[model samples]
Target: MDLSYTDVANRYRRQTLSILADERPLSVSELASRIVAHPSNDATNESTETQVRKARLALYHVHLPKLDESGLVSYTHETGEVTVPEGVADDLAEIAETFRSQMDE
Candidate 1:
């Protein structure tokens, strides 16, 4: 699977991918909170609960499904867990680092 930022350009998706690469097997709510706290997202004045809620909804209804379909992640809705497939975790770490640097620039 091409895990390139070009292929996964959405900021939320990119942040989710980055977080999962480093911290596998995160609960959906926890992952959403991490994504919201990730530096790549512009700081907002919104309450933490609101930010987390929005992130969670997006992950559950959209990003997770797309990433799961692409085989980059394994999301179990019943358990609300998200994990990077081991086969891709190393590659994802490398790719995510590269793109994250570029994003910082």
Candidate 2:
């Protein structure tokens, strides 16, 4: 199934926030691994390289654009590096915490 950029971004937002909370700067591959290994509360068993690639594309093409538009995060495409904006770290932390809380529920 195909997902809209916004759909993919929203679905993976918590996981992205979690990774950014612990690791400020990350490459796409690093982010993909983190998402696969530590998915959100609603995650399924569809974790694989292909899934990771789709997630990565969604992040780059969909999620990151939204985050950038909101000034919540920034990335350097050439370097494959991403970082949560200074003032948005707390927001990302909250997002991560929400995932943790949901997982515990």
CA error at residue 102 for candidate 1, angstroms: 2.0
- Residue-level lDDT of model 2, residues 4-105, one tens digit each, is 345224646656766688787988778877777763434667657777887789888877767666666687778888898777777667666766776556
lDDT of 1 at 89: 84
Evaluated against the true structure, the overall lDDT of model 2 is: 0.69
Among the numbered candidates, top lDDT falls to 1
lDDT at 1 for candidate 2?
A: 21
User: Where does the lowest 10-residue lDDT sum fall in candidate 2?
Assistant: 1-10
Q: Quote the lDDT for 3 in model 1.
A: 52
Can you write out model 1's per-residue Cα lDDT over 1-105, one digit (the tens) per residue?
A: 565544486777788777777787899999999988777678789998999999999999998898888888899999999998878888888878876897788
At residue 94, candidate 1 shows an lDDT of 86
Cα lDDT, model 1, residue 42: 83
The top-ranked prediction according to TM-score is: 1
- Reference-based TM-score, model 1: 0.89
Q: List candidate 2 segments past 4 Å from native.
A: 1-9, 39-47
